[model samples]
Target: MVPQRKLLKVFKKTTYLTTFLLLCIAWSRLRLFFLNVKSQPNAVEYNGGLIDDIKLMKCYRWYKNCETLYAQSAVHDNSFVLWNRVSKNMTDSSLYAIESNWLYETFFYVHLFNTNANKEDEKQPLADIAVSRDPSLVPLTVLQEVMPSLRSSDSMMGNKRLYYQKTSWWYRFWNNPLPTKMNLMNKWKHNNDILWSKIQHDSCLITNIQLYLGSNFVESRPFWKEIIHELHNEDGNSIPISITRKVECGFDANHTFPKNTINNKDLLQLKQKSDLKILQLSDIHIKGNEENSAILGEFQSRIFISRIIDIERPDLVVITGDILDGNKSVDYQTCILNVVQPIIRAQIPFVISFGAKDFSKYATQQEITDFVNQIPYCLNKNSDSNGHLTIPYNFSTIPNDSKDDYSNLITQNDLAIFIFNSKTSKRQFFKDYISLYKSPPKLALAFQYLPIPTYRLSGVFPIIGQYNERNLLPEGFDNDDNLINYMHEMNIKALSCGFDHSNDCCLQSIHDIWLCYSGATGLTAPHSIFMPPSVRLFKVDNIDKSITSWKRNYNKIDEVYDYQYIYNQPKQKHTPSN
Candidate 1:
């Protein structure tokens, strides 16, 4: 009778307790969200510190992490925190999580905002805006500044708590463990860490951050504010003093050689000691898509070589790969041997390697053996021809045409070019026509046919044979080994091969095994369909055993393969005749 008199009051008390628990959960979530936001701000930065599309993607991912964390804490546990003004009122953890998720979606729009900001930065007359408006760059950089708001409190929610939770006994029936804020926080942390690293390295980010904050993001913004105010006061004019122009002043150092250019004294001194000039051409897929004008452009291989020979007058030419998109038996002889080999003939001590496209997918061990036997001219006039193996032009006159004496064809260096032959995924289709005849009709994967892998795989494996990561070269091939003992090898200081086109080239090791790639002739063949075509000139002073790269890029389309090397420099400056 006494309980019945106050049933409503008892029910209200129980409900209040439940609501209080939920308030605690929401608060916990808020703490977790703050920690995540605080830890990941650097990840959203690009260039090594922050500023790029990848960074934006990373920010969006972090925001998504915040949503997932909320959903997990609410759905997984009956016990959770709440958003309370003065610790009296309570809110449901589930509803709070849902609201937090709404914030997540709202932040996703922030991503779009950042992307648009970047796009607008690209489209707008940044220079004019920077000069005309005192705070033109600040509005665009607002997003970077705004990110810190998410990290207001870190301790109550503690940064580490953003990542996980133990499953309640009631929730243990399901296969998956209870979701925690840490899932997204951990991922965001990883991504942001990468973004931070990248942004730290980026010059644009550095300069911009310097412009905005002066030294740090927060400090730089205030510094820029003062700078803008000062810049506007210079002449009492609306237009501010322009630092934007200064930013772009030294953007391209390569083309803008100084009138009183001081060459690197050591490099210049080395050049004086020995004339080591090299011609490097890479990623030249000859038989790619017909519309892919890169190959057609490179068809002017003869013209470029002629120009380079005239200009550089170098001793050697090194070709990396895609010698002619030879994925099949038909393409090797027709495109590569016919198109590129003629141009290579102009240089002495020409070294080359096999790109992936040169191998046969259907080739058995015997077929591979035969393929290697015809190594000198893997795909030449003699390939699928009347009984005669193809010979290099310089040594075509040598009688008794056998594989052993094939190296005798070249006049210089007393060294034989060991062309690597590696197969690709499309090799099966190339080796046999049946795969193409199937119902699905195996067409080439548009991206895979570029032969870039074949070029690199073929080029590198031989250099670093079946060796462990640290120990390069296969058994018996290492220095002071059985092969060295048997062959009495002398003066083989460098092993150079090319393919894997990149103008920003590198040497994997010292001269013992030099990994060199002669940038592509057709910039449009693979992923570089948008970039300008480029090439590298490698010069090696045989006496000094020194090598150097003269990287060059061409804006004009026709000028791509229209020049040659002379002493490791372009023979003629390709003036647009049109």
Candidate 2:
């Protein structure tokens, strides 16, 4: 009887526990179902059309005023306004009112046009509702469906706000004296009324609002731009700030590429002339505006280059690499612009021989090539792949008063100019091209970034300019003499390079081939203070059948120096001992 009672009790207890478990499960399922239904957006009915209603609602004012307020605050404070809402519980209501303008402007249209309203006849919420309520609680998915740009704006604005917050003084001045509540409210209301009036007057579709807001959000609330943001103090030095404007957006359409460009016809005309002057600029290590001081800004490099271009007025310009300090430059595009703008403005045809330091983790060689291609008057052929360019100017006949010594070598009075990327290992392309020619042209000049092995034998050979740094060859060519031997055999008259910043020497190697450096042409690069920035100039006189080279320094007093003949003057019979 006792065992039977115990078994009955156990069964009853088990039944009770099962019933409670089932009830809990059912309750949870019901709760989940209700939550899902709540999250789902309700169907909206448009009286005219969804687009027309949005246009009538003047929702675009929200976007325009939001962006306008953001820009104004950024300009006024010299920093990005914080996107997150300030705590209302704080003691300073005036401060809160002033600082919360961005948030109010950002969501004012959404609140006024509240598509989330349950019924078509339901009155829309006031614009200030978004400010009163916690912004995070708002349904982002619903907002996104109405205006896709809002999501992107929210994301970009928040990120920029946080980034600047960490570095800006505007965010740190919480304890500063605040305006009286009456004055703050009056100013706020006035600003709000102005924005409201503007919104009521403007009519735009939802798509237009999205487009305007999306495009201008990043532009208005930028964390970095071509112009560096800094605060001026009593000492005249500025305290650097983190906020900046959009560089691409700041680019003026009026800054078009120069119209002057060199073509086959132009080259032919130049060939007809007695001489062709070529300017070689190298090691222009532009590290962006921020990395440099006010005096040494990237703009200063452009100014210096512009001044030199005006003085030299060379027919052709060759930039021998290290055009950008990729690792240090905050903006590679701006850095590149600074370096090329001067040349582009001057409208001289130019080519680039990329150096090892021209690209870094931030900027790749392909990116640099693509950017350079956008500018006019640039003659870089295959700049992205191997940076190989071959320009052959074939004349109808040799000059009327030509020397007999050039009869064999100068078959057609053709002049050939080859630009190679020393950073590349593939020489087969040039080798094949050179093989096609039985003999070299009357004058052949090659431009590259790194000097050939012959340059290392500077002491052994007769050099014209200063030799300060040790010679360096590109990788994969350690103790390699193949390239040097090929150039010598091909009768390539001059090989100009620019990796060694301090070594601007033109060494007369065996077979009378000249290896020259363009020197460091930028202020930011590590160079001797004694040796100012300079460009190497090559004057190829077709009439003289000679190449004369010299250096033009930045100094106003003694600009030109190291004047020497590169080819067809006198042969130095010196050889490197094995």
Candidate 3:
């Protein structure tokens, strides 16, 4: 009886141990499965042509067989209509089989031969295959009409046609493609006319091909490569199909600067001069769309900016904020490219201080920073820099006088240009800037999107220029005095902001710092008054130890207003405008 009882106790202990181990294993496996699902990318990596080639061959064979059948049929009806009728009668046996007229048309476009279709010696087809996964249909007939002109101008390949496919949930879950690439490819087709105008001067072609199951952003992928084509599934979703050719091009494929590097001839010229001219273009709310009005407005804005750059010929350009109407823009990337084209063409060193609208459903702040930094002559600092810029200057001629030393003070570089993002942690960024250098440059100027509390106060403080609207402070900065104190402590002479479109004023704060506003430069943004679009210009003279600023209205007469000296000024009673 004692042996039997002991045996029962041992069995019970073994069963309990086994149960506990099994529970732990099950929990761990479940956790791992969830983690894997969470970590999986929206799109799969590009598989170089193994499966893609086989699929392409199958599609080609189906297309040839269909063409033969259509030619044999004596029906004189529209090819598109007849193809539909025939497809309805045919049995769907394979994945590549043309089961609908849309598929037949897609296949026809994809296999479209050049003018030398009958020439047997011409082995390689003139047109390459483009597959789109987007639900929106490409205007194949319109594109066909435009293709010859594009080919004649060398803007596109001879007669490329896009194929379509329907996407499946299982395929998307396992093999989705990068969204950025897909978006770009879709943009190329949808905004072909706009894209052609933008890239007509550059030679572009497809150098590499990739196949993806679904579309999603390349969060972990680097931005060095550019998308040349997109693959589409039957449901109208799209994936990145090809990479930009490795030739000299004007767009994203080729960038002059590496990450966080600043190389601009105009910036380098600052070392040799005592005076620097800076152009502040604010609120050029460009909405990249297909509308004629939108296109014309964007074009006019570019011309206006170009004319201003040519007229002012400033040493640097500072776009205050709201470069694009992010909410309204069809393509944020295209809008960004359009916004910066003038500055890039002028070869002027520029920095951007993004606004509230800059961060929208279309793009994040980091993505904008990354995209802008890639453009040539752009001095936009990396995310880590907290939007700080110091123009490099020669230190050999440091002024000996303590008073002049402040003016001539050069830390890592010569003049300090601090650009703050209103949406970011302003106080923290200020703290970080202060911590970086023991003392600030005497004539340092700051740029941001939203105005501080000091700008809104009336009475006692001397104000210049037009204050047509109320001031809007950045979030959590209404009662915060640390930023103003930091600017004062750093001896930052002036701070320029651009959120209030109607308020274009320079007010002397109690801290002796100049708080200025750059009026709206965009034609599309709202305006309380019947004033023309305008940009503020700042000229900093090291020899005179002064900074002069004024607004130039975009009109036939080039009207100028609110001219004021920022430094060494006397207190005045009333606001002035010209």
Q: Which candidate is the best by lDDT?
A: 3
Ten consecutive residues with minimal summed lDDT in candidate 1? 213-222
Tens-digit lDDT track of model 3 for 435-500: 665555555788877787777776677888778888545464233456788788666789998889
TM-score of 2: 0.53
Report the C-alpha lDDT of model 1 over 499-573, residue by residue, as the tens digit: 334332333332233333444664333424443445566544434334444555555423333222211222456
Give each prediction's root-mean-square deviation over alpha carbons: 24.3, 17.4, 18.2
Candidate 3: worst 10 consecutive residues by lDDT?
Answer: 49-58
Candidate 3 regions with alpha-carbon error over 4 angstroms: 1-271, 383-385, 388-414, 426-436, 471-479, 568-578
How many pairs of residues in model 3 come into backbone collision? 19
Overall local distance difference test of candidate 1: 0.31
Sort order, TM-score high to low: 3, 2, 1
- Whole-model Cα lDDT of every candidate shown, in order: 0.31, 0.51, 0.53
Task: Kindly list the per-residue Cα lDDT of model 2 for residues 1-578, writing each as its tens digit.
Answer: 99999999999999999999877745643553343234223322221111111111111222322211111121122332211121111122221122233223112121123344454442321111101012222223323433467765353222323211132353234211111111111111111211111111122212111111000011121112212123222233322212122111121222212222334234323334567788899998866543336225455566778887888888888898888676654445445555776676666677878776776454455666776764456676434356677655444543344322223344433567778877565366556555655556666788888887768783466888788988446565233467777676555788998888887888887777888988898877778777777789888776667788888876751368888887764446899899
1 versus 3: better lDDT goes to:
3
- Compute the lDDT for candidate 3: 0.53
